[model samples]
Target: MSEPQTEQGKSAMSEIQIPEMTGKVLACVDDSVYAEAVCDYAAWTAGRMNTQLSLLHVLDKNEGTTAQNLSGSLGLGAQENLMQELAELDQQRSKLEMEKGKLMLQAAMLRVEEKGIVNAESRQRHGELVDTLIELEPETRILVVGKRGADTESAHGHIGSHLESIIRALHKPILIAQQSFAPPKQIMIAYDGSATMRKGIHIAAASPFGRGIPHHVVMVGADTDVARAQLQEATDVMTKAGFEVTGAIIPGDADIALAEYQERENIDLMVMGAYGHSRIRQLILGSTTTAMIKRTKISLLVLR
Candidate 1:
């Protein structure tokens, strides 16, 4: 993941290399088609990294006050009976869904096991999704989430609705899985002149994602000597660190250009800051951290 030079068409220096990662990976699942896809993708990735896989399912109870309102709308006696029925039904449904999800996860675990991944395990919890995921062993290398969760029906929707809060709360790297993907042999790293981006370059230089993969470093802004200098500094850092960096200086709306670069390059993943320029606006719009969850179709590593 070393940064390279482009102004004079010179190549960046290469540095020491590390072995491929085979650490613990967490894959969040629910009773949805997307969950199944995520598990499959996770298994494939985990197998490649030679890492253990943890299949996590968080049973969220905050579906809102719809059930409460329905219970109270009925007469006192009838309300009690209706509430009881609804509660039982909800529990039953959740149980059934969990059962199906577990079966799906087990199937994925078996696939990974075939590849000699011996530490495959599964866990189910009845609590908030974000809180539960963070509770997992902090040594977990990556958290793999789907681009859209089971609750989303539109392309622009946030599948993992809690992603914003989770990104802000957790200090780890996140990989947002797109609809369908082969292993990302080519990844695009969005390099803005920010401390977060600095850390991102370091991570790319050191993490499993950047190992043996092509990394493209892109700076989105109006072309100018100042912009070039800023990007050059980043490129220098990465180049010194022994990363294979590709340089780009593009012009357009920031978000739009980013998304476009991802598509144009056929990028499989995007690593960038979650709450830099969009921090204030993001908190109000559930934050820029979460907005990316709704907008992109590639895996994202939101560094804090």
Candidate 2:
């Protein structure tokens, strides 16, 4: 009788487990509309994982005062005798920049808490954005950033170099919020049967990040024999980790399949490797990774 009750309680707990996303989630906010959307995505994800959210804004001194000083010394300065006037101009610019940074940071914090997550906070940082995020990677379980930057010039191509740096530098998973997303309905795992993908699957299945979430394991391409074997292997992995897994053999390019599947199935997140086929191979085919990053509208969880 006691055993049955214990089992019942355990099952009940699993149903309400949310995402088991403990620890703090670090979200980078900038002056873009997408930044606040990113914060919303972070709060929703944090609420699902039952985690705290930390909003970060980097002042980027290189883009501000230091750059001006270096430029003035490098002959961009006026040849007129108003050296004192130039210095005063620099001082005013610096003050305005600092005030703008504070306003942006405060706004992001308010948005995060507006969703009622209860653990949202903000931090204003100075220096390179990617460097600061990487510095806090040990304590950060997940890093959230906007898919495209606030600046229209920077938003067009691939996600800016800063996002690329954060993705490559840190081992923690990153969630890129596109448009906007609430709680995930059904999530997709990009299981390629590679060692890194295997690690990603294990993390999703066993970690709190996947609590109570239904997942579809997609094996892309036409290797019937290999795909079958890999699918079975993934099944065993998830089974051992105690997950309800549904899988499919998707034909065509992995990138195309990912985007289409997200739209069709409403996959809230796509979990896959940042780079696969070893470090050397990853360097060779890194553009495919970038292509996928630009193409998807749903959130992505990229593991190193």
Candidate 3:
């Protein structure tokens, strides 16, 4: 009888364990201003999920590939000899670059650990950023990146170039970091009643991610009866799950209304669906997901 009771306790413990999220949250870090925020959010997520964290920095050589142009003039044989020597010098330079990458990883790890994320790890590699993410996809539960990366210019009038591609590629949620870190107390949802947006709501309410945190579901429209009905229906779902819920219809366009609501209500984090339209379609019609992300400075928890 004692053995059976002991077994029942173990079974109950197993039953209560977190079901989703198979791996660590991998945050792609670079020297850009966004990297620190990425680390901060990664630590927060890892703490929330009771999971591990991994920080990765890719050299991304393809973006700025260039060949050496040796300056000094020399006789033909001497030039060939110098080229060989330069080849050796290039090898040394590559080694140094790898060392620098390691140093960056070490520093990022310290930042995370200092933030109380004890299970954090770091990786340094040389490859296309997208390719590196694809290779590491199997071991990743979530992906985190900056809205604007180091090459922020190329992404003018849009989300980060790498960010757009990564969202399109990954099946997991992506957290877009802002300039600084603040542990979010209130999460505002850009609910459109789409399957993906609903999934984001369910994840926040059911999973360990936002337990006890307040939620506000904001739908953008002209404030008609139909809009209020839709907002109430979604709010009911979250409320039934025991999340403190606030449902409202904000008047304006999607991007503008969301920005105003977040500002007015002091929303700490924004959650919404992503990439619902085709690239060609967005090019002609404009993407609300991209536009909204670009407008806000707070962290966004984007769902697919």
Candidate 4:
């Protein structure tokens, strides 16, 4: 973990008036296969909103500290030599990682620029991923991140370890990119009439993010009259906002129903309120937000 930023440092960061930091669509990229998708989705969003795009790559501190506590059972002089050699090796590895990050960022920049995003910029930082994103939260309008990282590529049905932490740490809207990108022709808003979901609906209605796209307001539960009424209320908000809206009250588990509806409707993006329950509660009884994130194949736009 990195040290917390000092008040003075925070103030300095606030004062640094970079034009790109204001309302920029920030995308976090790594060497994972989803990095290209993240860049592409971010480029599409930035283009739609007419905002600047920024790419961020965070180098985890633990990734560079593999030499610690490895000098076991060696003669004192030999141990010292080995420790020195390991230190040099660590330095070389850190340098290589830094160079690799630069190349990745360069490639991402070129990719977005090719998509007609000329104002795109990139940054490389050192620290944990969630911490880095929290520090940059002030500058971010919409944050784009991959569902899984390179470390978790083979682990099917598991989201990146940093994903939940990022959701918990930042208040900004996050877009979790899948393995591919396509412009969203239709979007589904997972609504359950909770305060958080209501806020999400309001944000979606007020913003131009998905203004002209067709919308599906889906609720998972028995198709009771009350459920229909709630779904209608939610869809009405979007309909009044000039969106072509369709409301559905499906049956079954929340995550399963939403995922099924999304696929059946060919929804390109699913927007929902993220983690409405407490962390401890979610730990005891699994989170639908996390489950949906893992289950769905399409990208998600999650609001806090």
Model 1 lDDT per residue over 1-304, tens place: 1233344322221232333334478888765556655776777667756677888877676543235666557788998888888788777777776677678667767755665667879887877787787777375777777766667635465455666667766766677776665677777777766556665665666655567777788887777675677577667666766767778988775667878888988888778776764556544655444555567777676665
TM-score of each: 0.78, 0.82, 0.85, 0.91
Model 2 worst lDDT run, 10 consecutive residues: 1-10
For residues 1-304, write the lDDT of model 3, one tens digit per residue: 0011233432332233333767889998887788888888999898988888999989866433333665576777877888788777767777777777788788889999999988788888788898889899889988889888877834544577788788878888889988789999899988875556655666666777877889999987766665565566678768888999999876678888899899999999999888776689889988788888888868898887
Whole-model Cα lDDT per candidate? 0.67, 0.72, 0.79, 0.84
Clash count, candidate 4: 0
RMSD of each: 5.7, 8.5, 9.6, 8.8
Which of 1 and 3 is ahead in TM-score? 3
Candidate 3: worst-modelled 10 consecutive residues by lDDT:
1-10
The best candidate by lDDT is 4
Assess candidate 1 and give its TM-score to the true structure. Answer: 0.78
Q: Write the per-residue lDDT of candidate 4 for residues 54-165, one digit (tens) a residue.
A: 9999998877666866556888898888899989998989999999999999999999999999988899999888888988899899999999999996777999988989
Rank by lDDT (best first): 4, 3, 2, 1
What's the C-alpha lDDT at position 6 in model 2? 31
